[model samples]
Target: MYVYLSKIVPLFLMPLGLIIFAAVLVLLLLVTGRRRLAAWLLSFTVLLLWLAAMPIVAGSLYGRLESRFPPEPLARIPVSSCIVVLGGAVGLPFAPRQDIELTEAVDRVYKAVQLYREGKANRVFVAAGNQPRSESGPSEAALIGELLVEWGVPADAIQLEGRSRNTRENAVNIKPMLEATGCDRSLLVTSAAHMQRALASFKEVGLYAYPVSTDVRAIRRTEYTAMDFLPDAHALAMTSDAIREWMGQKVYQWNGWN
Candidate 1:
């Protein structure tokens, strides 16, 4: 239930949806001859919303939230039951090409494989659940598992937790397996940008999962420049992800996950 709610909150909070309502309101206000008031208020509101999303305006906010946890050291190996990699890639069967492929989230699997190869963890658990809307339509875990196999991590060394639909559910569902296997702790593999929320969610469920973050997005820099302020879809997506993780952290805290 909580996992489903996490997916919905972002749609409403991001203002992508609310912008339509605000635009209609602005037009109605203008049509009624309150042009001056509408113009002033609308301009102010739009400016504020844009500013809220502007990377410069929100960079520090994202930085603070992202910095709550540092990236795990690549050289340091931790003891664990298994390295748990969270799912982000979805199988796309609707495309003209039919072969399975890696999506952006596949980095999570790659990092897990690297760790396993380095002997950081003896076993790997891919937590990929079903995305009903997907095309190839298998649980993300299955897709990642195949990738791991191709990468030469033997099939017997990998466990699939394909029942989880989201991070919260991933944590909820993986707990019993962890206990049953007599594993006390494990390294959690995910994007560096999303490690904070993932760790918090798992810990909330009483799992002591250490974070091994991959796919880092933010870089620390003292020099500010014009390009940093420019709006780019790729940058906006990263910023949005940062904000979503921060918001998820707050929600998890409210649920006593922290």
Candidate 2:
């Protein structure tokens, strides 16, 4: 439910949605002709306000979620029964061998497999559930699990959490599967920028999992120029992800998840 609401809210909050509202307001002003200038100004103001709230500006307005889960030496943590991998981003929807492709979130799946093989966890959990808006038809966890099998990891070694529709549900739904597999605690894998919310959601359910973040967002580009300011849709997408995660974190805290 949380995931569904979050995905839908953005359609009404972002620049595109606001642009439509602006156009309607502008049309209203032109039709009324009584306060044309004032109406135009109001419409433009609303558009500008929505743009300002875009995630591209502040990378979620809470800075990057990196510091919250710093890199820990693998040796520092104890091995567990399973390593949980949360899925979000998916590769091209219609690729012939789509399961093999990797996206920002898929990097966590690969990392989870590596951790499992390295003795960090005896089993791997792929939490690939997604909301209805997901363009990729397959549950992310299932796809990654297939990829893992293709990469030589036995199907028996993986636990796919495909029913969860959001982070909160990911935690809630995975509990029974983990219990069935005798996995009390496991490493939680996800993009570094999303670790804060993911961990909090799981923690809220009384499931303590170690953070193992991948798909870091910070760019170390030496050249910072006009392109940074220009609107790149991909950048906007990443920004939205960061912002959504931050919003999720706030929601979790408010719900006493922390």
Candidate 3:
């Protein structure tokens, strides 16, 4: 229940969700015959959305988290005993397409592959964080594992973990697998915005992880084009993700999972 609530409750706290919430409140005010107040609230909501969609605002919010663990060259990073890539990189095959649908965060997988090929570890734990029997189809781990093997990573080198749906769960579920790897140190790979929560949760589980973050965003915009001020759907989505990652860290800390 906590898992489901954690996913659902954050919606109302982010950009689009907050906009919808305010819209509903405005509607209620209109139904109560408070036309002037409803108009005022509607205007406020529109402005909020516009600000959220602006690249400057969105990038500023996410940049803090994404820059926390900036990308480093493979040679600079110490080779750990194991590499774990968190889920959220791909979608399962369904219906018309049998191919995996890679998301923007697919760098998570590519980075893991690079680490493996470079002899960083003997095993790569590919976590798609879904139940194996997800009605949507196979777990993302299977697709990623398949991709890794096809990309020349040996099948024996990939350990597919399909039972985690979030960072906290990833830390919890992978502890045993990490133990089996018989390595004193391990590298945790995920989007830069997620490294904070991922590292914290792993610490709570008694595992000290080496942070290897990818998919960085702007920590600061040095120059602004006109596009920076314009409203963008992608910017709005980035804002939503930033809001969630920050809030999720707080929630985890509150629950003693961080």
Candidate 4:
């Protein structure tokens, strides 16, 4: 139920969705002869859109999330502990290619491999499942495992937990696997923005996962340029992601899943 709702709810909360909603409301008010209300709604919507596109606003929102957990150096991660890499790093393949395609969160997989090569962890676990509407193909975990093998990690050193569909499910499903392997502690690899919720979910399931955040989105700017204040679609997208993480944390807490 949570998984299904999560996938659906975000569509209505993001910037595009909010803009559409506001537009519809304004149309309704104008049709009802409430011109004053319509004008107010239009202005509010435009202001929101402008704010959402500002780089400074996007950076600050994303920074709050990505900074929740500082990146852990590979050398400092416990040696021989299991390294668990969460999903959201890969997209479903559109067509067969020579290699699997990775998304912005590819840092999760690469960091996991680096942990293994540095001898910080003897085993790497890729926790991801097939996309909900995806057609036949290996799951995300399997695809990442293949990449690990290509990167010189032993095939036997990698484990696949490809049944989880979200962070909560990832924790619930991976618990049994960890227990079976006597892995009481693990190095958790995921996007820096998602680490807070991921850590909370794992804790709820009784796993003490040491955070090794990846794919950090927040950046510190030493000087602001003219372009810094310009409206950017990418900034809006980043803001949406940060808002989603914030909401995820709140919802997880409310449901006692974290």
Best by lDDT: 4
Q: Rank the candidates by TM-score, best first.
A: 4, 3, 1, 2
lDDT of 4: 0.87
lDDT (CA) for every model shown? 0.75, 0.71, 0.86, 0.87
Scanning candidate 1 in windows of ten residues, the lowest lDDT window is 230-239
Candidate with better TM-score, 2 vs 4 = 4
Which 10 consecutive residues of model 2 have the lowest summed lDDT? 54-63
Q: List model 4 lDDT by residue over 104-157, tens digit each.
A: 999888898889888887988889987577637778988888888988889998
- C-alpha RMSD for every candidate: 2.5, 3.7, 1.8, 1.5
The regions of model 3 sitting more than 4 angstroms off are: 131-136
Error of 4 at 93 (Å): 1.8
Please, what are the lDDT tens digits per residue for candidate 1 over residues 28-106? 9999999988888788767655755666755666566657665666787576677888988646445675867677767
User: How many pairs of residues collide in each model?
Assistant: 2, 1, 1, 0
Backbone clash pairs for candidate 1 read 93-136, 128-141
Winner on TM-score (1 vs 4): 4
- Encode model 2's per-residue lDDT on 114-227: one tens digit a residue: 787778877888887756766457677777788778766789898787877777788889888888888888899887777878887887788889888777665544566755
Off by over 4 Å in 2: 1-3, 34-63, 71-78, 89-101, 133-138, 220-223
The TM-score measured for candidate 3 stands at 0.94
- Residue pairs in steric clash, candidate 3? 129-164
Superior candidate under lDDT, 1 versus 2? 1
